[model samples]
Target: MTRTAAIIGGGVIGGGWAARFLLNGWDVKICDPDPEAQRKIGEVLANARRSLPGLSDVALPEEGTLSFHADLSEAVAGATWIQESVPERLELKHKVFAQIQAACAPEAVIGSSTSGFKPSELQQGAARPAQIVVAHPFNPVYLLPLVELVTAEQEVAERAAQILTGIGMLPLFLRKEIDAHVADRLLEAVWREALWLVKDGIATTEEIDNAIRYGFGLRWAQMGLFETYRIAGGEAGMKHFMAQFGPALKWPWTKLTDVPDFTDELVDLIAGQSDEQSGAHTIRELERIRDTNLVAILRALKGQGWGAGALLTDHDKRVRAATALAARAVDGVTPGEPILTQARAVPLDWTDYNGHMNEARYLDAFSMATDRFMEFIGCDADYIAAGGSYFTAETHIQYVDEVHAGARIEVKTQMLLGAGKKLQLFHWMYAGERLLATAEHFLLHVSLETRRPSEPGPEVAEGLRLVAEAQADMPYPEGAGRTIRRPG
Candidate 1:
């Protein structure tokens, strides 16, 4: 059954939450008072569609239904998960939550995306306070995996964490409530430093951003502050490093003790600098640029299977198992419609200097398609782990046309041969109906224990036979046996 989520606000953060759920195949209903809420959310979704699926080689679930609601109660009705992302005002959130509680399922979770207000404050004068949890997600929530989960109730927190994990998020549950939570507390410290730097003219906004992104930000992406510091400790380890640097806390290198007033002059100075720096790009344009860079970095991490990349990998695996293919899970052998071997948007990072997909990514796409086809043939993860799997013996790719970034592409597989130790397949890559590339993959079944070619299990063999028979009547694909030539 399709799960339902109700989002109480439609701003940047709320829209991000919606994307995380909706793109992951959870039916989402949003309540926001803004007249432009639909348009705003549409813009966010557009960027999300272009970026999120690129993080994984596997295709994401078919997106869930989205609807806008004018009434908060109507939005919360029948929702399995209710998230309140109204403005940061405590009174406003309490009012919204009251209406949400009146209509929500008794066991449904109520989450507040209030970065500033603690849960204790939000639950004041509210109905269902015990169910209200602080579920703060960062901006661009669909791409970033970290979620700060804070609630007084243990079971509530655990259940919330599980739901977040299902959607490919890493929820950090705080043992107790604190204003601003953990990440924000640390971020607030650095944010104060950056503000002071700009106020003092020590650095411009762009320069300060460059300092972090070009330096420790990369380290911090994989390792949090303390772990990075531990590595800095080198041969001595964290204790020695802390002992050596502990005294630096008193150096007053930061303006954390007091924040600069948001006076007219200071505001003008910051605004002027920002305008001179990045005013040319619209918010939507900047979002795409930010999302593109984020997708590239996350994909790189996914390759390492560490940090955010691991989150993405988990997301992709669940994505395959949750939606379209869920009914045909490995345990059940019933064949359904030919599963989509690949359905993805060309990420901006995949483009070369010439602004088309790099020559190599075409093969990458084909290889992932081959993975999906393997899953369909019943020789997937489980079969491989049991000591038998197919190995790619040779690959031939023919690029017929250019594929650009943001293009939605799909791949269709044709079984050339699937019997005994030989498993040959062909995939045609398409940007909509236009075929842009064709790839032929020849594979050999191998026994991992013996390190030699071997016949697959009967189940796998039967599965392959079905696919081969299904496509046997189809005409042979063009460019099957063709090789490169000076003149043809």
Candidate 2:
């Protein structure tokens, strides 16, 4: 069954929420009075379509439908998730919640995007107080995965977390709701100090930002604060670091409790400095730059399988598993046919200076297909762990056409030969009906214990026999067993 999400207000954050849900295959409904809501969400969706799918190796689910509704009831009708992103006002929120509860289902999750308001406050006059939860997400919500879920109800939190995780978000559940959730509180502290610094003429806005992006910001990106500080402690760890820095905490270095008055002069000074720092680019341009930089950082973290990157790696596995299940549901791996192995968009990093997928990535795609094929024949991770797996003895790739970033590609594998101790396959890669490349791989089953070629296990041998026998009568693939030769 398809899930539906109703976005209460279609501003930047709400639009981002819509894009995130829509891209993740959830139908979206927008309930906003603003006439520009459609255009605004369209731009956000454009950016999402360009960036979000590239985050995963497998293609994302087909984008869900989007529609606009003039009435709250119409929008909330049949919506499983309703996100409220109106301006932060308690009275206004209460009114919206009453209207939402009247129209939305009792079990539908009502997520408030208020940065500072607690769920309790939002649920004050609600018919179903348990349904209202604070699911505050960061800006550029389509790209950022963190969603602060504040709710006292365990059931509500679990349901929200499960839904958010399905859409590739990390829900930080806070049982005890505070005025400002965890991340914003940390940001507010830094904001206050930065304000004081500017007010005191100690550092300009640009200078303060420079201090972060060029210094501890990088460390915080991957390791975070305590771990970074623990590393700073050297061989002794957190205890040593705390002992050294503990005294300094009382030395009047920070004005944590004090705030600078928000005078017009101060506002002008900061805004002027910010304009001087980044006046050249439009907000959209800045957003794109931020997104690109974030993608690079996230991809790097994914490679290391640490921090947020680890989350991304796990999400990829989930996507792959879901794809496999869907494929199996459609047709059990039938014999005498080319098995659909890989279907995904070419990630941004796969391209090189030529602005097309680089040479090595072709082999990477084919290798992924090979792995999928191995799994189909019962030679999976567990099988390999039990000391038997396939090792490529030889591979030949023919690049017929160029593939660029964001192109949806599919790989289909034909089991040319699958016999005892040997597996031979031909893979054809395509973008729709356009054949882009072909790869032939000859692999031998090997014993992981001794790292030598060995006879196939019973389960695997039976699988190989089924496919090999079924496909034995199929015509030989074109260009099979060919060697590199001069054009003729």
Best by lDDT: 2
Per residue, candidate 1 scores C-alpha lDDT tens digits across 198-247 of 99999999889868864678666654565456545545544455556756
In order of listing, the candidates' clash counts read 0, 0
Q: How accurate is candidate 2 locally (lDDT)?
A: 0.85
lDDT of 1: 0.81
Assess the local accuracy of residue 453 in candidate 1 as a C-alpha lDDT between 0 and 100.
97
Per-residue accuracy of model 2 over 382-448 as CA lDDT, tens digit each: 8899999999988999999999989999998888777678788899999999999999998999999
Cand. 1 TM to true fold? 0.57
Q: Candidate 2: which pairs clash?
A: none
The alpha-carbon deviation from the true structure for residue 97 of candidate 2, after best TM-score superposition, in angstroms, is: 0.2
